[model samples]
Target: MSTTGLYQDQHLEINLPQAMVSVDEQRLILTRKEFELLAMLSANEGEILPRNVLLDRIWGYSEEIRTRTLDVHIRRLRKKLGLYGDSYIQTIFGVGYRFQRFREPRALISYQSPLFAATA
Candidate 1:
């Protein structure tokens, strides 16, 4: 599994048969819930998955839980990603989150008038 990043490329060499995730430098020891969450997000990268969806997938909850359990798990996953976490995981306001392979490109167009310009 190859994951492209901004500064450096990140990949998870997983043995699907054995259900193991290994990085180049260190092994990311994940809890059962963490592993499930990571797998789900990785499976659908760049897609904005809602909180309810996550809860249903990971927790298998029929009814919504009034707690920050999903948030906590996400935080842990972010921590596991270390320094490069910020660039990969993005927060969508009033919506959900998305696991990105790379940072989104910034717009080049400028709305404001130029402060200095050559006079004709």
Candidate 2:
């Protein structure tokens, strides 16, 4: 089994000590908040972390505090990671987000963006 980041079978790797993340062996640059966010999600792979929990953990803010920072961070992270498939983080809609797990190494086809529908 290939253990890259927080979980096995994942192509991405997060070196917390180095504060770095690599996708498909390519290094990625992220802001401080972005790195923290990725680390949290990677640490809790397969588990859905609520927006409130994420904010509290990463930003050290109470759940009652209102902010769209998490959303912005997530968007930026996704863009940097070039993530688009089920193997990456997933939105739970009105709830939270989950870092999905990979069962095996995937091919380019698996990275197909959901933004583009399959043309029959």
Residue 7 local lDDT, model 1: 21
lDDT of 2 by residue, 1-88 (tens): 1244444345677787677778888888899998888788878877899999999989999978999889989888888878543457
Instruction: Give the local distance difference test score of model 1.
Output: 0.68
Clashing pairs in 2: none
User: In candidate 1, what are the lDDT values of residues 1-120, reduced to their tens digit?
Assistant: 234311223444444445566555667788888877777776667788888888887887655477688888889887887765666667777666787775455889866556665556
| Regions of model 2 farther than 4 Å from truth | 1-10, 84-86, 103-120
lDDT of each: 0.68, 0.78
Residue 110, model 1: Cα distance from true site in angstroms: 14
Look at candidate 1 and tell me the lDDT of residue 120: 64
